[model samples]
Each structure stands twice: as C-alpha cells, then as structure tokens.
Target chain A: MPKSVTLKDVAAKVGVTSAAASMALSGHERISEKTRAAVKQAAEDLGYVPSSAGRALRSQRADAVALVVPNSSAHVFGHLYFMHVLTGMSTAANAHDAQVIVSTNADTSNGGVAYERVMRSRTADGAIVTSAAIDDHHVEGLVASGLPVVLIGNYPHLADAVSVGIDDVAATEQLVEHLVTEHGRRRLLHVSGTLDHQTGIDRRDGFLRAAEMHGLTDVAVIEGDLAEESGAAAVEQVLRERTGDERFPFDGIVFANDDMAVGGLAVLRRAGVSVPGDVAVVGFDDFGFARVTTPGITTIRVPAEEMGRIATERLFDLVDQRPGGRAHTELGVEVVLRGSCGCDPERAAAPGPTHSH
Target chain B: MPKSVTLKDVAAKVGVTSAAASMALSGHERISEKTRAAVKQAAEDLGYVPSSAGRALRSQRADAVALVVPNSSAHVFGHLYFMHVLTGMSTAANAHDAQVIVSTNADTSNGGVAYERVMRSRTADGAIVTSAAIDDHHVEGLVASGLPVVLIGNYPHLADAVSVGIDDVAATEQLVEHLVTEHGRRRLLHVSGTLDHQTGIDRRDGFLRAAEMHGLTDVAVIEGDLAEESGAAAVEQVLRERTGDERFPFDGIVFANDDMAVGGLAVLRRAGVSVPGDVAVVGFDDFGFARVTTPGITTIRVPAEEMGRIATERLFDLVDQRPGGRAHTELGVEVVLRGSCGCDPERAAAPGPTHSH
Candidate 1:
C-alpha cells in the first residue's frame, strides 16, 4: 500500500515544527492566524488527513460523547421521552461535528467503572447522564472523578454538578393551578410517577404545594411507575373502590407525565366517566399523541429535546475545557389547554365526522 | 502527569517486543496464550493502560459502529420503532465490547462523504443504514467503496447487499387474510405508508394481493405518510365522504403501522363507529401503546430490536472479516390478535373501568 501523507508532511511543507503544525491545524489560540491558515492550506494541498492514530495523538480527543440513558423495561424504549432526548442529543452532536456513544442502565451503579474505561480507552471524551435518580451514587462518583459530566435531569443532592433540566416543580404547580383556578376544581387526585427519580419527587411536590395553596383538604396521590400499565392499574383500583362524591370526590386528576395521563383518560372513558364534564384531566410532558388524542389532552409541553441539546452542548464545552458560562439551566415549559381540562374546551380540535356516537 | 505508563513499559516489563506485547494485549491469534497472559499480567501489574494515542496507534480500530437512523419528522423520535431499535443496537454493541455512534439522515446523499471521513479518521469501523429507500444511491456508493455496510431494512433492488429486515409482505398478507377469514369482511380500505420506502411498497402490494386472493372488488386504498396526522387526515376525509355501503361498504381498515392505526381508531370512535363491530381495524408494527389503547389494536409484531441487533452484529462480522453465515436475514413477524380484529376478543385485556361513554 502507498504511504499516506501525515502531519509531518504538512509540518515540513509549512516549514514548522510538528507541534506547531498540530496546534495551528487544531485552531489553537496560541498559534498565529497566519500560521493556522498556512498549516490548513498545506494539509489540504498534501491530502494530509490524519489517520485514526494521528488524529488521536494530535487532538487528544475522541470527538464523541457518551449518552447514558435510563434503561427501564417499559418506558425506556417504548415512551417518546427518551427517544426525543436521544434524537436531540444526536442532532446536537452531529451539528458540532461529534457523534454520540449511547449506553443504557436502569440505575447507573456501574457508570463510573464503565465510563472510566471509556475515557481511558479514548472511546469518548465525556458522558451525558440522563438519569438523575435520588440514589444515584455513581453519578457522584463520576463527578468526584473529575471527568467532565453533564446531567440531563435535576439532582437535588448534587447541586454542584453541571446539569440541564426541565422546571418540573414549577410546571406541575402551574398545571395544578390551572385546574383549581379556571376549572373551579377542588377535590383532586395526582397520578404521580415513582418517587425514585428527581422528576417524580419534584412534580409531586409541586402538586402538594399547589394543593395546599388552594386549601383543598380532599386530595389523594397514587404512585405510578411512569408506565401505562401502572396508570391503568391505579385507575382500576379507584374504580373498584366505587369512586364518587360519597368518598374523596376527585373533581380533577393531574398526571405526572403524558403516558400515565393517556392511560387514565382511557380507563375513565371505559368507565363511562365524561372527561371535562365530570372529571377534568391534565398531563405533563405533552407527548406526541397528546395533540391528536381524543378529548384533546391538556398538558405541559416539556422541552425534552431542548434539554438534550443544551446538555450535549454543555458536555462539549466541559470536554473541550471551555467555560460554558452556566453550570445549570432550567428550561421553561408551556401549558396547553384542551378538551381534557374544563378551563377551555374551545382550544380542543374539532372532533369532526367521528363525533357522532 | 507523572508520565503515565505506556505499551513500551508493559513490553519492557514482560521482556517482549512492543509488537509482541500489542498483539498479546489485543488477543491476536498470532500471540501465544502464555505470551498473552504474561503481557496482560505485566500491564496490570504496572498499571500501564494505553493512552488514547497509544490505543489508536496499536489496535488501529475504533471498535465502534455507526447507526444511521432515518431522520423523519414524525416517526423517528416520537415512535417506539426507532427507540427500540436503537436500544437493541446499543445493547448488541455493548455485548461485543464495542460502542455505537449514532447518526440521523432522511436521505443519505451526504452519508458517503461523512462516512468516508468517519472510516478514514477511524471514528467508526462500519455503518448500519436503517433506510432502504428505492432511491438510496448513497448506499450504492457505500457498497462500491468496499466499506463494511449493513442495511437494517430490505431493498429488493439491492440483492447483493447485506441486510436484516422483517418479512413485510407475508406479515401484511397474514393481517389482511385475518380480516377476511375471521371477520368475514369483504369491503376493505388499506391505509398505506409512503411509496418512497421499500416497506411501504411491499406492504401495499401485500394488501392488494390478499384482496385479489379473496376476490374482493369493493376494496379501496388511501395513501398515508406513516404518521398519526396522515392517518387522521385520511380517515377524516373518508368520514366526510359519508362512508357506507352506498359508496363502498368498507368494513375494515388496515393501517401500515400502529401510529396511523391509533389515529384511525380515534376518528372512528368519534364518528360513533364501533371497532371490530361496525368496522374492524388492524395495525402493523404493534407499537407500545397498542395493547393499552381502548379496543386494543390488532397488529403485526415486527422484530424491530432483533433486526437492529442482527444488523449490528452482521456489520461487525464484516468489519472483522469473519464469514457471517447469511448475507441477509428476514426475521419472522407474528400476527397479534386483539379486540380490534374479529378473531379472539378474549385476547384483549379487560379494558376495565373506562368504557362508559
């Protein structure tokens, strides 16, 4: 095989040291603009693209980010949440001329050992941790190890870690407020996600705070694992108990996420409960089908994709040793009103020809 | 930095040449078992992990696979199909002691140039192309360049290419036959995905052939973009046309995928059409929400994850120059019966509590 041109050739052509050529080619601030231009032109002229070894040796970068996602059996691969995040992360990486290396774990206990090896072997420069569970010790270890890490979700305990997350607490509070104020909803039920993760806890906290603010004594909370099965099961128990004004009359239900909300809506529909007319329902993380579903689900449109994009960009800034300005960013969310909520049925889409029955 | 230990240090300690040490470390067949063990022990003893540069220079392999998914607006991130496939692909790579580098493209016109650099720079060893579009000329260019390539979906014209895909034709055919034999439905409407993709063409062909076999002349077809919105619009238009025995007694609707099917179900329910009663409905690619949806969507369960896993493994086999037994793998799909189909409403979950209105 013919010998390929290398950094040495470019250096020689530009009459500079190999280190100078590398720095200039990499656009180092220390290198003069004149030298940078000269090195780049010479590299192009000589067709001196860095081989894997040359690139690895010269830049000392993998140009890759490891995205560690939660591997829940039901939600991880089935729900649109992670998919949207991954897509956004991938898009951001692509735009930045980097690629994403994805790894899935229910809890990231083994993250450190695995990610340490990843960094040591030059498989990736840094990692973006998507799961910000309450008991995520491995994340603390990753931060302690001084490896550039960016958390995709909020971790209350690890306040110092770099992160980009949604305003889960405020968003949920807003949804609850929407139900209480405009809809005149007093007795309520919050179908919450598990308390294991920061999102669930924060959202539930938001619900309780909102409930207290409304001074509603007749309120209840049911824990769901953020899956449709959990939501259906929870609602089934409610039906079996013969829910009505005789007991804790829940005028409205607030779901921690859209998945559970959709399930709740279906269960309520089957039971002959009229949505909005009887029990108002509102959801979080306005999933893709939210806009199109029957009764037109009222929801909070979480910036899942934006979170992924920002987290990725933050990871790159950390990996490249640049000051990324903010260490934490809490993106804003929007409240979308529809037929599911009693506030405004006008915002819902026309049921059209299929509304006959 | 305390001069981190290198391959040279390991070799010196093991009393072997650097080449021998590298071969032993990499588990090359040329290296004896004793040499491999000794090199490994000495490297461990000295804590001599190859730095990023050294690993690249010695192994000459990135040990990563690039997964290029379709960057469609609606389905790519929102649907379960892509997420499940990605999760499985990532898992397969992890099992093989490799990592997955993800990319997205609607059309792969720019793939060759990007992937050409990816390989040349040792960013990834091979790529798995998920799109099997009829006009996928970049795939042809990739094949011509002798790069290790694996297509996740089937393309009939590319007979020489390696691929792993579902038996789309048989799966769709079986679905249509079920609608006829079990439901005893003569008039039908097949909602098809876009014809630009091989999947769409084959599925549409399957529906047509099944109709021909049944000798049903009252069947009609509606074109969709494999999106919920597409399915909703098509069904809406049908409803507006006053669909009945007058125009064409369409008793069942076969959706190309679950997203569209879910959309169709909502439109029908709104219009007072009872599923599997007034008109049966069946969907393809049993998505996550299929089981929980009211009336339970009857659909085909495509091995999306398996396809991704198999395609990844095949790409690695080709990259490692191993003779993978089969050049193509068409995984079998199963027909799932539920309340939406005429066969076995018992199979549907007791959508208890929420069937009232």
Candidate 2:
C-alpha cells in the first residue's frame, strides 16, 4: 500500500513521456498548456490519486454527473420540485463518489441531444443545466463545448459559466410582502409559468416589485404551463372576468408553483370561492402537496433539495478544477404560514411541520 | 461515417496486435477466451460499430447506466413513484445513446455502496437495482460482481441475475378482489411496509391470498415505514384496538403506499372516519398525492414509470451483449377507481380525473 502513485510516478516527476504523463494528467488537449502545468505539478508532487481507473483511461471520465432535464419542461416530471432536485442531486452525487446521469431532453430544440452526446463521449464529469432558457443555445452549447457546465438557473449571459439559483427576486419579494403586509391584500394576481423561465422571469419580477412597494395598482399577469391544468385555467379566466362585467376582483393569487397552488385550490373549490375569504392564495414550492392541501397552502420554501445539493456541489467544484466558491450560487427562501394564507389554522391542519424548508 | 471502422481496422482483420485488438475488443481479462472470441469474431466480420470513443478506449465504458436507489428508501424522495421511474429511466436512457446514473445509497447496509463504487469505477455500464430487498446482500453484491446487474425488485435467489418487476402477487390479488368482491369488505386491515420488502413480501402475500380466497377469516397485519408517519401510526394502532375493548371491526384498510394512503387519509380525517363511510381505503402507487387526497384513494396502479421503462430496456439488453429478453421481466398492473374505495362520489370530488393512472 505504500507504493501506489503511478502514470509512472507522474512521469518520473514530470521529466515527461508516460504518454506525456498521460496527456498531462488527463486534461488532455494533446498536452502543452505548459505541459498541462507540469503534469499538474507532477500530480501534486507524486501523491497521484487519479484512479477513477486512471481517469477512465485518460479523460473518458465516467465518474458521471450529467443531470440535464428539459424534455421541453413538461412540468418537470410532475414536479415534486424536480423530485427534490433529483434527491439533492442523488445525495450530493452519493457524497462525491459521483454518479448522477439523468439527461431527459430528446431534443428540447437541440438543447440536450442526449446532453450533447454525454459531452462528446467523455461520458460525463460535469453538467447540471436544469431547464435553462435565457439565451440558452443549450447553455450556449455547454459554454461552447469547453465542458464542465453548471447553470441551474441564472445565465447572466454566461460570463464564466457556473450558476445555481434561488433568489427568485428575493423570494418573490417575501411572497408579495406576505400578501401586502400580513394579509391586508390588494388586487394582485400573478399565476405565471412560461415567461421563458428565468424562474418565470424572476417570479414575474417579484410580482411587479411587490406591487410597486405597496402603492398597488391592480396587478394581473396570467400565462401558465406550470400545469395543474394551468392553475385551473387561470381560475377559469378570472371567472370569466367576474361574470362578463369587468368587476376586476382578484384580491390576491400568486401561484407560479406548488402545482399551481393545487390548481388554485381546486378552482376555488369548484367556484364557491372563499379562501382567505375570497382569493388570497400563495404558492411557490413548499410542495408535498403543500401540507396535504385542504386549506393549507401559503408557500415559497424553495430549497428544492437544497438547489439540487448546491448544484451538484457546484458541479463538483467545476469538475475538480476547484478554486474558490460562489460561481454565482444563491439559495435561501422561506415564508410558509399556511391555511390558504389566512394564517395558521392550528399549524395549518398539522402533518408536515418539523421545521420546514 | 463509412470509414468509421477503426481499432486499426479490427487489428488488420484480426492478425492481432492493435494492443491485441484493444484487449480482444475489450472483454479484456488480459485476453485469451480463445483470444476473446476471436476479437469478437473479427469485430463482427468487419461491420465494427463500437465507437463510444472505441468503447472508452477499450471498455472503461462510461456509457453510463446505474440507477440503484436504496438510501434506506425513505419514501424514495417523496415518491411520484420514484419520479415516474426516473422518467421511465430517462426516456429509455435517451433512446440508447445511454446515460442514466442516479445511484443514491451511501450505504443502505452496503446494498449499493455508491452502487458498488459505480461498478468498480468502470463508471457504470450496468446496474438498475431500485428497492430490491429479500436476501439482498445489495443484490448479492451485484450478482457476485460479475457486473451488468438488473434487479429493480425481486431476488428469486439470484439465479443468474436480471429482474425487473410488477405483479406484486398479482397486483395484490387485484387489490384484494376490489376490497372483497366489489366493496363487500369483510374485515380486512393490512397497512404494511416493512416485511423486509420484496415489495413487503409480495404485498403480504397478496393480502393473505385475498383472505384465503374470500372465505374472509378476519385479517389484520400492521407494520409500516413507508411513511406518512407510518400511515399515521397505523391509524393510531387501529384506534387503540377499537377504543380498548378488543371490539375489532375494521371494514377495510389496505394502504402499502400513496405515502401510506396519504397518512391513512389524515388518520381518517382526524377520526371522524366515514371514508367509504366508516372505512374503506386502498393504496399502492397511484400517487400525484393520489388525486389530491380528500376521498380520492382507491389505488394499485404501479407501472412506476413503466417499471422504470422496462427495467431500463432490460438493462440496455444486458448492456448490448443482447440476447432475447425475459430474465424475469413482469410489468402490467392497474386498478384506479376513487372516493376512498367506496365508489365515485362524483368521480371522487372531481379534479384530476381524465382517467387517472
């Protein structure tokens, strides 16, 4: 056991040629970036632990990672928030002895093509992507094919690739300031889904900047595909705009998740409508059927499997070329309080509250 | 593409030495099973299609597959039946340009030690496993480490591996003959989850063989771990064995899933009972919170992402060694109806009924 370090001991401490120290310790582009930093500093001065079977025989790296998602986002597989971010990216890629390989998109407009043939057959070492869309040429062909891609949400025009998200504009401006200061409410509506998804354009710009810091002006948005029959057809198109007469009555709705707030509380219980006494319902991703639905649902939680375990541990610190953290990570959001936002009906009819989020 | 037959043209038509035709076309144990079937019959008589970079430069095949599961199956990531069998095994491993990886178990008592270190670092070319238990030395250490494992559920004492499942004892005797001949319900209970799982011993031997083929000898059983707080603590231990007087009268129960029938319908809606009027519930995996739980449970659906898309298309037909199918496949199961097994209270208070499941 004391004699293990090979690639001929980092090519005899970098005097080179063990196929140039296995193509400069497998970063490979036919070596020379100053001999791949002198065969990675002679494999960290000969500790040489590179055996994922010698990096899958010099750079075919099947330690696996992939994730990908986007089969044209068909409600991301009936969302348990992408199955708790694929079980926190398979329990942080099984605590780093990695393997996650999800892949889906049979061509979300050419974005996955089996995730660009598993990163051109190197067969995966990095890739997280999740439903990315802003200027996404499949995340610009995985950052123009250089590889180790990350992007779970924000693109910020790919400035140095990696990403991870949460601040859906300050958790939809603290759930629209708890529906306008602890339920005083105002004519807000939202609904949303396909604003070409940057989390539906930062939660419809945090529900119009919390209805313009409370000077509320009858907000009303709509468009949905984040299905629960598109939030019960946006509450039957606002009950045919209040029985064909522009009564404009939405005293608060929000949605954009929790399976469209359990289809807007079963279309406001088949239209008798009296949640928070008439409308107030919020939702984001406090999902497990938002505490078994019947009157419980005021949400925002969103640590969706801790943003899939910190975006696969920041794409394995950008696939082991680790450096500093925060390559734009975000995560942090929670609001909770249930009983359709009217307040805690006995801890919202109990069941899942062992300190949520 | 016509000139793609490489490995030095099948080692110059098998006269050998292209590194012994890349270790006898990668079945590698340092060659010689009669030179690995004559370099796979001279690369299949020169048609030669091997290139996942020539099978990852001779079989370090990160062409990926793994799935695994068992991190002590804590309701397998809030089960949408394992996210529709991981989206039917990632759409049949993205139609065979393969890559699926999931993995999970960071030790469910060694039943997938990170899926046997991603198949001993060959970085996965086989393995499916998901929830298998009976005699499972983590699926007999993946069929005695010969690799290409398949399991999904069933052990049948390993007899030459490959498993795939469904038919949990004839889908629990067609859900206990629809609760004893279409809701006659002669005293049954079940609940189950931890019968050391071969799907809780084939749904408790299909509920005691449909209570001894309906001769109805008051059945009971209990155990649970398939959480919703273990079916709300097995309905408070059968309501403390019927208010402490051993007055045993359980109309019908069943459970085994749908997160313990949504915690046994919130403990029969906080004990007022009346589901199918005083008790009748059935559940197996027809989850999407089994149609927004109020009275909508009547269950047993399980195609669980079409048995994870036919056990990952028969583990990609045993990772392309391809023979015909059946190494114990199983599939087919559906029962569905609603209103807590009584029958359609207006199609279970109508919400998701476009024929669910």
Candidate 3:
C-alpha cells in the first residue's frame, strides 16, 4: 500500500499551520470558509486518508452511524420504501463526511444481539432506529447504553426518546376523511398491520376517530401482519364469510401500507371486483408499485427520505452533544389522490418516476 | 445494565464445564449436537450477551460482515431488487449468529474514504462487494488491503479475486432467444446499463451473439446508467432520431434492469405506442413493480437473495481460513414471460401480488 497521507502534508500544501488545517478540515467556525475549502482541496489532492484509529482516539467518535431496523422477517427488509430512507441517511452521512452502516433485526426480542455487539465494539458513533414499537425494550436498551440514538416513527411511550418522523394518526385521519366525505363511503374495513407496531395502533386509532367524527355506524377491522400474503388471506376470509345482499361487506378498505394494498387489489381483481366501483381502496406509503397498479392506489405519502435525513441529523446532534435539539421532529404527510379512491385516476396516477443518485 | 451472562452461567445451566460450553458455542466438532443445542439453549435462556471485544481478541474476527455497494447516484441505492439480496445476506448472517452491515459508496473514486475507514477500524470480519464496475479502484483497494472479500457479479479482469454470482451472459442470451424465437422480434435495441459494468458488457455480448445466431442484421445498442430516468431519456432520444416508416425505429427493446424498464414503459405510454403491438419490451430483474405495469413487463428473474446468500457464505469461508472453497459459485437465471413481450396480455398482466412481512 502507498504511504498514507497526513494532516501535516495537507497543512503544508495549503500553506497553513497544522492547527489551522485541522480546524478547517473539522469545519470549526474559527476558520474562514475560504481556508476550509482550500484545506479540504489540499487534503483531497494529497490523498490524505485519515487513520481511523488516530481519529477515534482523538475525537472519541467512530465517524460512522448505524441505521438499525428491528425486522426479523427477511421480507420486511425487502420493502423498497426503506431503500429511500437508506439513501437519504447515506446522503446526509456523506455530506457530514461520515459513514452509514445498516443493521436489521437488532431488537431486544432477540436479546438485542446485534445492538449489544455494535455497542460493545463501538462500531458506530451513533445510531438511528426506525419504526420503533410502543414499549420497545430494544430502544430502552439503547437509551440505557448511553449511546446516542434517534428513533424514526412515533412512539408515545418513548416520549423521552429523540425521534424524527410524521404523525401517522393525523395522516390516517386525513385519509379516512377523504374516503368518507368525498367518496361517500360509510361501511369501511381497515386492514391493519401488527398492533405491536406503533404505526398500526396509531393508524387504527385515527381510523376509529375519523369514523366516529363522520357518525359512520358500520365499520369493520381485519388483522394483517403487514404482509401482502396476509392481506390476500384476509380477503379470502372476508369472501368466505359473506352473506345476503352484501357479498363483500365493506364498501371501502384502507390498508396499513402499499405492499398489503397491492395484494388486496390483486385479490379483488381475481374476484372480478372493480376497484373504486365496488370497493374504494387506499394505502399508506405510496411506493413505486402504487403508480403502476391498475386504477393506481390512493395512498398517504410519508416523507420517508426526509424522515431518515432528519433522524440521522438528530442522532448526529446528540453524538456531538448539541442540546435543546434532541426533541421529536415531526414532519407532515400528504394524501396522494389516485384512481383507487375514485379520483381523476389518469393524471393522479402519473408517477414522478423516482430517481436516485 | 444487568451483568452480561457469562460462559460459566451457561455451562452450569447445561451441566457442562465452561471450556465445554465455549467449545460448543464455537462449533467445535468435539461437542455432540445434543450438547451444542443444550449449550445454545442455556445461553439464550440466560440472555447471554457476548462481549465483542473479548470475541475479537480471542478469534481475531469481528463476527460481522459488510455488504458494500458502489452507489454514486442516490437512485441506484433505491433499486428495490437489492432488498432481496440484503434479505438473503441478513438471513444467512443471522443463521451463523453473525451480523451484516450494509455500506455504500465505498469506492476508490472517492479516495477510498469509506473503504479506508471500514478497514482501519476493523468493523467487520470480511465483506461482500456487489455490482462492481470493470475498473473499480475501491474493489482493487479492497483486494489489496488483504481483507477477506467476496465480489458479487462477474469481473473478468479481477482474475485473482473471489466472486459468487450468476452467468449474466447466459441469462441475457436466454432472454434474447425467447424474444426472437417466440415473439418474432427482429430489429432489437438493447438499452444496456453502463458499459463500465461487467453485467452490461456480458449482457450486451449475449444480445449480439443471440442476434447473430438468428441471422439478424438490424441490431443497435444504447447506453443507460441503469436509472429509470436514463431509460426514459434514452426513449426520448430514440424517438427524436427516428426516420420514415419507423417513428420509434425498433421492434423490441431490452432494458438492463427493471427500474430502467419501468421508465421505458412510461415513455412508450406517453408516445401512444401499444406495447407488444407496436414494439415489444422486456426488462432484467423481475421486481414486484413489473407485474403492475399496464402491459406487465417480461423480465429475467435473477435469484438475487440466493446470490447474496452464496456470496456471503463464500466470504465466511475465507474468514474462517478454509481452503479449496474460494471458487466462483454461479447460480441460474430464468425468463419470466409476461404481456409486454407480445404474450398473453390479460393473464400475464395479472400480478400475483408480492408479499412482505
């Protein structure tokens, strides 16, 4: 291997003292922007690769962050939407000159196996945990470990924990309102994710709240473990139990996420049920698949990438010991109109064609 | 924090010596399967948390692996198919009681910034690098770093490096044969991913070889950076450069991946072109979105998760210093027929609905 470049080399090239160079490289406000740029350029030109050991020793930081998702099911990890979050986190970490490491199934249910290893090894400076559940022992363990951590998605029980995400309850309420007022749908069936997840509980609560507010007496709920197969199975169960005038009891079905919605749509199609005409359907997380679906799925657009960025930014703040900024950062969500909700399906179905770079 | 359960505790619970417990936990052949199971059960029951520091000191291994992808564009990271690969790797790692850490942009083009940190910090026992380009300095640096690394996707130039993946050439040939023999597509336009990538080169070669075998003279190729936007833009360019009697020019178009294929399909729709009626379209990587597209894209189904599992298994083999197992492990691919490629539009368009937990 070539001789590793040093900070002194960068300082000499920039015609500045090592202290000045260090300040500039570190983005310390004491150094002028021009000096900082020059130092960074010089460092780049010199191929100044900082030794991880020396940097860790000097700053007592790993210069890396972990993005942990407590998913035991390999299928959940395959959710394309989380890829957007990963991209956002990676972008933010790259901007800060830090690395991002992703770990899945690092939950307390598994004895916090991955988390314990990461913390004990000091593999990362801080971590951003996503989709935290209510009364999650993993998050509690992370909190108790004295590691800088930030949670994405709301958890009222984790009120003291730093989090950055949207209000799932409000988003679902808005969706339900749209379904009720605009579409004139009274009998609704909610296909929910696992209650263990805070998202499922919050969305279900919002659905009930909206139903009560609209004075809708006929309402039903079905359990889906946030999987497409479960959604299809739920449809099968609903179909098997139908009687009288209403073959399908519900006029509208709201799914917890787009993945399950796709499955439900498929089941409906196989049964020769026209979307919106027979059963108006809506889903959360407007994934790429939503646009391509027949009639397009009306869904809630969560700012997944933005949430990831903000959560990472919060974790970095805690890692840097920045005070007063560790509170929950709640962003807003939008209800995307599409054909599945009896909207102008053509134009609304137009996918903005997501691009990543 | 509660005191971490030690080997002694597990040993006592299993009615064995601490040394025996350690040997069983470490998978020593001296221990019987029953003893190993008992020891593991005891450890789990006691919630034994292994100290990474102690494990590292004893085994000179991190008990973790890094799955790194060279993603310059933020969009590339969002390629939904990667989730399968990640799921596979994570599942395999979980089975081995090891951890999987995902990292991106660990390229030498960025002065090997991420790679240097990962290496210097010794964050993982080994790494599995995916979709490596032909002249990737980052991968070269990784190989030279003397780190036990496995490359996914082929790199003919890196003759000395260990790799595990499928035969991209054969897969592409199968796609082309299906297109020509079954669909009767003569004029073919291949929208290849960046030629700098081994996949692109190999696939392009297959297309040419298959066309030659069919005695076809009209064949063209276009460069795409594997992003959906690029595929859409390429469609626009082709339309702009079309001649008389052929507004679109090509009878069939094959995209490198599903993302680009989705983009191409959108452009085709905007142009009022009938898929398979005006021009047949096929894509690589049969992502879930492929089924939902209006015409349902015919695609090459690469066993992504299996590839991930095999590659990771290879990396672990090297990490364990096992000999005669560093061979290139190639899996098979299948062509999934759907509507876009001039097949049964109705039945093929039916999405069987993907499931995620």
Q: Root-mean-square deviation of each candidate, in angstroms?
A: 5.3, 20.1, 7.5
**CA error at residue B93 for candidate 2, angstroms:** 18
lDDT of all predictions? 0.75, 0.73, 0.77
- In the range B270-321, model 2's lDDT, one tens digit per residue, is 5556676657888888767877765667788777787888888888787777
Candidate 2 docking quality: incorrect, acceptable, medium or high: incorrect
Name the weakest run of 10 consecutive residues (lDDT summed) in model 1 chain B.
B347-356
- Pairs of colliding residues, candidate 3: A356-B74, A356-B75, A357-B73, A357-B74, A357-B75, B108-B138
Rounded to one decimal, what is candidate 1's iRMSD?
A: 5.5
**Model 2's TM-score against the true structure:** 0.37
Superpose all Cα atoms of candidate 3 onto the true structure and report the RMSD in Å to 1 decimal: 7.5
Best of the two (1, 2) by lDDT: 1
Give per-residue CA lDDT, model 3, range B1-357, as digits (tens). Answer: 233456898999989999999999989999999999999999878766555545553555567788787654335677776677887787778767776766776344555546555654565677888876788776887787667888888877887788888887888888889889998999998999989889989888888898899988888999998888988988888888888557568889988887788888878766756577777888988868777665678888888888888888888788777783546778888888887887875654443222101
Q: What tens-digit string does per-residue lDDT give for candidate 2 at A1-357?
A: 023456776887768778788777668887779978988887766545444546654554556677777556754764566778888887788777666777776844432366765665555677787776675476686676667877777776676777888788788888889888988898989988888768887888888888998889988888886778889889888888685544338878898887877887776665556676667788887768877765667888877788888888888777787784767888777788887877876534443211111
Give per-residue CA lDDT, model 1, range B68-132, as digits (tens): 65443325554577776776787678777677777665323432345555654666778888754
Clashes of 3: 6
Considering summed lDDT, which 10 consecutive residues are worst modelled in model 2 chain A? A348-357
Can you tell me which runs of candidate 1 are displaced by over 4 Å? A1-50, A70-78, A105-112, A240-249, A266-278, A289-293, A343-357, B1-53, B70-78, B106-112, B239-249, B266-277, B342-357
TM-score of chain A of each: 0.82, 0.36, 0.84
